[model samples]
Target: MPEKTTAENIFGSIVETLAESGSKQKSVSFFGEEKSNPVASQFNRLFGRQKPVYNLLGGGKSADVLLWRNKKVSASFLTGATAIWVLFEWLEYHCLTLVFFALVLGMLAQFIWSNASGLFSSGRSQTKVPRLVLPEEIFVNIAITISAEVNRALSFLQDVASGGNIKQLLVVLASLWAAAVLGSWFSFLTVLYVGIVAAHTLPVFYERYEDQVDSFVYKVLQQIQDNYRKLDDGVLSKIPKGKLKGKKFE
Candidate 1:
């Protein structure tokens, strides 16, 4: 009886040990998934962005168009822009000439329609053709929007020029320099079209590969910060500034 009890005790101990180890393994796996990538977590915290990319882009019609949610509308807009670019750039068509030709064709069609309708009618009365007149509100709204955007841009430039933040000043200067370099390389219209194409494509691709992009961007930012720190420690720290002193009165 004593030997049998000893064997039962050993079996029970083995079962408890195995159960504990299994639970520990499960817990370790759960926690591992929860803390998979510390860098991604740090990136999210640094940016303070808890929303998804779609919401970051305002999550409306504009975002939908950019992300290609409505494929028909998005494709139509892209095709129209491509057509216009091709017409002007490849075909060498002048904007004013195109507008003149379009207007002449529209006027001729309307005139023919009006005259034919009167000729077909039994009565000898002339039919009045409807004129195409744009609304005053459309022009007024466009002007107001343009003025507001211009004022906003001017305010931003003034603020940047006021020189409170050295970092901001450097960034603005770098951006302007980059823009100048790009202007030297390509015409304004080409640059604008490229920007439009980027806007149409980049957002969707970023959304699709968000995790990889975030990881890459985090590494890039970390490397930039390290380089800046090295620059500051090596060069900036060595620079000496002259002390300003008040003149003594006689």
Candidate 2:
């Protein structure tokens, strides 16, 4: 047999190891829904959907601009939306009294502001700010990915390695371990690992969302996971059966 150099042998081993280990994580689901254009979905998901009410983008009636121009009327809509989301969260946390208080106070503020500032406005030709256009689906997907990784790490450490810690201790330590492991994994892989796999099966998850919009991140993740599961199963089975060899370095 031809003598293989140390560098070649090491690179070959690394490639083989990666190819083998890759399959185990191939099937894991990251996020809840599928996305077509993640950045747009993220924007809509975060800032709430843009309405035809005000032309925030040029050639439009600037609701926020109008609010700035005539603080009273604009404040009502702005405050109302803010309060609604805030109140929703408060209610979710079971803070009924606080929600009631917020409602009462929010109503009073809107009432006072509406009377004080007359609702009159015009569109301004101000330049728009440049921003990273990550979609809601992508944002959600990333969050889900991070959460799943952390959860997996903790579960692996706690359940698989029983007697490692008490319940309270497990809760504390698991959170910490999960964060560290997740951070490390993200730092190492970036999106290339998942992105590559997602490319193969795009059509499988290409369902439309509300309206005519499609989600990108969700679909990508779905495909990636689909491919990953297949990869993981294939690699895992071949692990022990595969042959290994050594070479000396000069």
Candidate 3:
């Protein structure tokens, strides 16, 4: 009986040890998922992106359109853009010619409808045709918005030019160089259409695969930073910088 009781006690202790180890593993995995990598946290803070991509993009109807929250509206916009691009690029249609043709068609339709109604309504009152007058407020609002954006862009450029941020200056220079290269490759209209297409497509794709993109971007940024550091160490640090004496105020 003593031997049997000792064996039972040993088995119970072994089971308890296994249960404790299993619980520890479960706790460790739960906490591991909850905790973010310290390096990733540092990089995220450095990148100054605390909000989600959608929220950073104004988080309204514009965000919804870009992210394709409403498929019908998004598809309609893409279709309209594609049609315009096809007309201008493929059909080689001039803006003024298209405008005049549209006006002529409208006038013809109105003339036929007005005269045909009179001919068919010999014993009845003729139905009134509605006039197609565009609202002045739409044009005014569009002009105002464009002006504001232009002013803001001018202000931002001025700040970047006057500011002492070498990284930002380099980024602006690189972007301008890229734009120049792209301009050499494609016409302005083609570039604009491409930009519109990219704006419609890239945002939705990025939103769908945000985590993978973020991970890839983080890796790329790290590599770029390391290369920049090496360049600075090898060349930039060796460059002679003149020391300026502060003016004395008596």
Candidate 4:
């Protein structure tokens, strides 16, 4: 036989795997019932018969809207839209330049203060002026950080896929797409700075107003869960299972 190319071999293997799985399903049906998945069963017990994600994605919106009806999706859509509008309408070229210039002035002021107060001269025979961070080092560090983040994301997706929950996968995919759409409207540095600032400030604010914030968040989540429970009982419980197309539903 002529040797198969890499693509041909991969295609052949996929076809073979499908054939084997179909045969196994048939055999199980003829001989005995296939074993049930305990984990899937547990998942069903927790969120089955109900919309896997009922409250948040659903309310006052048609289910036909697909992923757009989600709370986070709406939040992100509005945030992105507002950001773009501000960038195009209110913000000017000089505004952006001045923003960067302000940072430069702040650093210059800090340098002057430190030198005047003998901070840079404390131990050295002569005061040494600090140089700007090298562009190459900055780019290399960013590349390394991005690579690590991508690997971590891939590993997380692999673990979730292994769980075999279609609903979970859909949620993850929807969230990622929404985040990417939002990210497209803003620079990575802007997002990073906002995230960093939020990380620094939000904790202190929460700590200061712990009880009130906790109570409010608890009430909102409680309301959402209650709505989910109601919707599940009203509609989702009545839907019957059907065989999935293109494969034997196992």
Worst 10 residues of 4 by lDDT: 45-54
Please tell me which model should have the higher lDDT, number 2 or number 3. Answer: 3
lDDT of each: 0.76, 0.48, 0.76, 0.58
Tens-digit lDDT track of model 2 for 96-205: 77778888997787665655444332344433333435589988999998999999977876774576557766677787787688777663233333333342222122
Lowest summed-lDDT stretch of 10 residues in model 2? 203-212
Which segments of candidate 1 are over 4 A away from where they belong?
Answer: 1-48, 122-128, 227-250
In model 2, the Cα lDDT at residue 160 comes to 41
Superior candidate under TM-score, 3 versus 4:
3
lDDT of 4 by residue, 1-250 (tens): 2223433554565566556655655554456566434454443332123433324335354331223446565456546755754664557335577689889997988778657757556775655556656679889999999999999989999988898999999999898897898799976656664664454345445434333344334444555565556555655665687977796788
Number of the top TM-score candidate: 3
lDDT of 1 by residue, 80-122 (tens): 8889888988898999999999999998999898989888877
Candidate 3: clashing pairs of residues: none
lDDT of 4 at 220: 46
Model 3 spans > 4 angstroms off: 1-46, 228-250
Candidate 3, residues 1-250, lDDT tens digits: the string is 6545544555565566556544544454445433335576445542576777688779898888878888898889989988998999999999999999999999999999988998899868776988988999999999999999999999998899899898998899899999999999987888998988998899787665444445545655665565556556655676799999999999
lDDT (C-alpha) at residue 171 in model 1: 93
Model 4 CA deviation exceeding 4 Å by range: 1-146, 165-167, 184-193, 239-250
